[model samples]
Target: MSSFRVKGGLKLKGEITPQGAKNEALQILCAVLLTEEKVTINKIPNIRDVNKLIELLADMGVKVEKVGPESYTFQADEVDLNYLDTQDFLKKASALRGSVMILGPLLARFGTGRLSKPGGDKIGRRRLDTHFVGFQKLGAKFEYDSKQEIYKIDGTNLKGTYMLLDEASVTGTANILMAAVMAEGQTTIYNAACEPYLQQLCDMLNRMGAKITGVGSNLLNIEGVEKLNGTEHTLLPDMIEIGSFIGLAAMTKSEITIKNVQVEKLGIIPETFRRMGIKLEIKGDDIYIPSQEHYEIETFIDGSILTIADAIWPGFTPDLLSIVLVTATQAKGTVLVHQKMFESRLFFVDKLIDMGAQIILCDPHRATVIGLDRKYPLRGIRMTSPDIRAGVSLLIAALSAEGTSVIDNIEQIDRGYQYIDQRLNALGADIVRID
Candidate 1:
């Protein structure tokens, strides 16, 4: 395993361009199975999870060729459906949560899919019951071995119908949407996750001739099509990484610019940071953050202390709550962070507390941060990453701390961010990777 050793107290400057969205890239890659023609995807992030998904695609007889630094051509015309049952396929599929998306296209195009339980950050018990229930409503039958965690899905012709997801699970929503596009009848999905990534998926599917409506809302209406054709699509820039960069610039008091951020697609992200009193300048597709001395936490309407929380769609994304919490540690005021989605996500505040952050862990899901206000910088300390978001949060914390800090379990960071150390170093961040 590798770790990041950082000499902190460095002001990161210069422009950094974010790679493609990892979530969107994974869903787009799986959509390749829906067509026989060659699909070229540009700006795909070269990350561990993406590489694992590509390997899974290759194992299933899909031809993937790297045409550029962050571009690939994928053709699934010669897929072997039986490859899903192999141990290698099972291992790779079970390693990431995005693997569950393969089930939809696989079952839709090939009539069946077999795989093991999917694994990801152990934030909470993310149930696939919503996914299976939605698929079953669309004429798919699912059988699973609880002991081995193997799942088998079989269906003849997927017939779309009115379905309501119990929870707006992101992957679950994507899986059902993929399946419904090629179904026999009209599919109406209520309480769907309409995040930017899902919106991109819907847009790409429509480009490939799948009829979908309500692109940015909780209710999605998809018309089942007989076939989908291949098309070249460019993935959206990583909004989560863009948010992370914004926080890093604020904490380190750096003047930095983020390039090619799809300003229109970043729903509620820039506004959420603005609530923290961080001003941003938009120059076309780029976001510029000038040097900042302190961030002020906004108060509620009734003049009460402000508490920022995360919700499903059109709300601040739950993935960014960790970065918000760490950024608050260096801000000028106090705020309570309520993470409703994941239970274990707030546990990383303990590491921030060890670095002299004034944090009160209200519970497993809430934390109150008292900002240092430039009166004191965080002290460097050794910490282990618990998951992907927390790992990157620690890296952000380390960048603003004094002296040296070591962050272990960096593979967790590798699962999401592509060439993170190199990219950050280009922005004048003092980070080194060590094994």
Candidate 2:
């Protein structure tokens, strides 16, 4: 197992450029299967999950070429469908959730798609029923082998229709949308996931000859085209990483500038942090955070304690709640961090509590953090990372702690962030990778 030896209490400085959006890459990379033309994608994060999906594509005989440091050109002109039935393919594809997205494009273009149950963080119950039902609504036949944990979708004579999703599942919506974009007739998707990644996918599809309207709204109208062409798409900066860096700066009392942030697309992320009394300046497209001695949690307008909760897009994401919880450990007041989407995500608080943070685990989905206000710095200790987000959260906590801390199972962290230690070290963070 690999671990990170992190020394806390050092103020980080300099500018950080967030890598490509991990969530967006999952959807867009799968879209490469919808077309046979060469699709150029720039700003692809060099991370484990993304690379796993890319590797899966290569295994299926998709021609992939590296054009730049963080960019690639993919041509799916020749795909070996037989490989999907291989045990090696099933084993590797089951390691990441993003692999589920392949079902849509493969079915859309080739009339068949098959894969086993995808694997991901064990944070909550993420069901694929939404994706299966959405595909079925488009005239695809679905069959699941429970014993083998495999899903087989046959897309023959698919015709577009209206679908009101049970929930606005990001991957489910993207998967169905990819299928709907190729089905005959008009498809209307209500309550669709309108995240920036979805919007970027829609934009890329439109550029490639798909008729999709409602770029940033829940209601979407897609007119299926016979075929899609190759198009170049650049991924946006990872909002989760950007939010993580902001919390890191505030927690460690660092002067740092996050460069090239798409300020307009950040949605509710910045305002949520501001609600916790962290001050940041937006200089054009970048976010600048100066050193701070202290930050206080704000109460509600009615004199009640402030509660930060995760919602769908245009709302605070659950991905950042851990960061907020850790940052609040150093703040001056208490606030509740509610993760409505997942149940087990809040379970990481015990580690923070062990490191001297006052947090109350209200339930499976909620945590109330009472700030220490830096009255006493956290005493770093050895711990293990449960998941990707929690690992980064612990890393942030370690960065702001008073002593040395060791975090095991750092592969969880590498699955998302690209070269996290090297990038943070460039900004003066003292982190060492160990085996």
Candidate 3:
């Protein structure tokens, strides 16, 4: 297992550019299977999960070419449908949660899609019901083999209709939308996830001949087209990474500028950090967070304790709650972080507590952080990364602590973050990867 030996108590300075959105890249990469024409994608993050998805595509006979350091051109002219039934396919696809996305495109185009139980962060139970149910609603025959833990979907004669999702799941919406793009008729999806990345998918599909309306709203109307063509698409900067950088700057008392952040799509992330008393400035498209000796948390208008909770898009993202929880450690006041979406995310607070932060693990879903006001800096210790967001949060804590901290299982961090140590080292952080 790879681990990170992070030397703490160093301030990082310099401009860092956030990588391409990991979440969006997964959806966009899967969409490449919809057409046989050449589709070029830029700003692809060189991360483990995204790289694994690309490898899966290549193994499935999609022709992939590297055009630049962060650009790739893909053509699915001769996809091997037989590969989907192979044990190698199950082994590769089951390891990636993004693999489930390929089902929609494959089902829509080739009439059959099969997947083993997909794997990802073990944060909590992320059900595949939404994806399968939405497919079933689109006239696809769904069957599950309990013994093999495989899902089979057949869309021989898909004809779209209306669907009101039980939840606005981002991946679920992307999967269903991809299938609906080439269905026989109109498909209306209410309560759809309207995240910026999903909107980008809709825009990309529209550019490729799919008629999709309500680009930024929950109600998406898709008029199915007979075919889709290839188009060039550029992914947005990862907002989660941007938020993590903001937290890192505040926690380590660093003067850092995050460049080309696509500020308009960040959606209340900056303001949410400001509510934690962290001072940041917006310059054109970059975010400048100045160093601070101490910051404080804000209270509600009625003078109640501030609660930082995650909601659907337009609300604060759940991905950053771990960052927010860690950033609140050195602030002046206390804040309750409600991780509504995932139960196990707040479990990392025990590690922060070990680092001299005062945090109360109220339950599996919530944590109360009492800021130390920087009076006593966190002292580093040995810990293990549990999930992607929690792993990055622990890294931020280790960076601000006194002395060196050894973090095991940093592969979790690498899955989402691209060259995190190298990038931070450029900004003056002292981190060594012990492979």
lDDT of 3 by residue, 162-269 (tens): 999999999999999999999999999999999999999999999999999998999999999999999999999999999999999999999999999999999999
The runs of at least 3 residues in candidate 2 whose Cα sits more than 4 Å from the true structure, single-residue gaps closed, are none
Kindly list the per-residue Cα lDDT of model 2 for residues 1-435, writing each as its tens digit.
Answer: 999999999999999999999999999999999999999999999999999999999999999999999999999999999998899988988988999999899988998988888889989988888899999999999999999998888899899999999999999999999998999999999999999999999999999999999889999999999999999999999999999999999999999999999999999899989988899999999999999999988999898999999999988888999999999999999999889999999898999999999999999988899998999899899999999999999999999999999999999999999999999999999999998
Candidate 2 worst ten-residue window by lDDT: 310-319
Runs of candidate 1 with Cα error greater than 4 angstroms are none
lDDT tens per residue, model 1, 1-435: 899999999988899999999989889999999999889999999899999999889989999999999999999999997777788788888998889999889877888988799999989877889989999999998899888789999967899899989999888999999999999989999999988889989999999999999998999999999889999999999999999999889988899999999999998899888888787889999999999987788888897878889998788899999999999998888889999988899999889999999999999899999988878889999999999999999999999999999999999999999989998898888899999
Looking at candidate 1, the ten consecutive residues that score lowest on lDDT are 81-90
Give TM per candidate. Answer: 0.98, 0.99, 0.99
Which portions of model 3 show Cα errors greater than 4 Å?
none
- Which candidate do you rate higher for lDDT, 2 or 3? 3
Task: Give each model's whole-structure lDDT.
Answer: 0.91, 0.94, 0.96
Q: Count residue pairs with overlapping backbones in model 3.
A: 0
Winner on TM-score between 1 and 2 is 2
- Judging by lDDT against the true structure, name the best candidate: 3
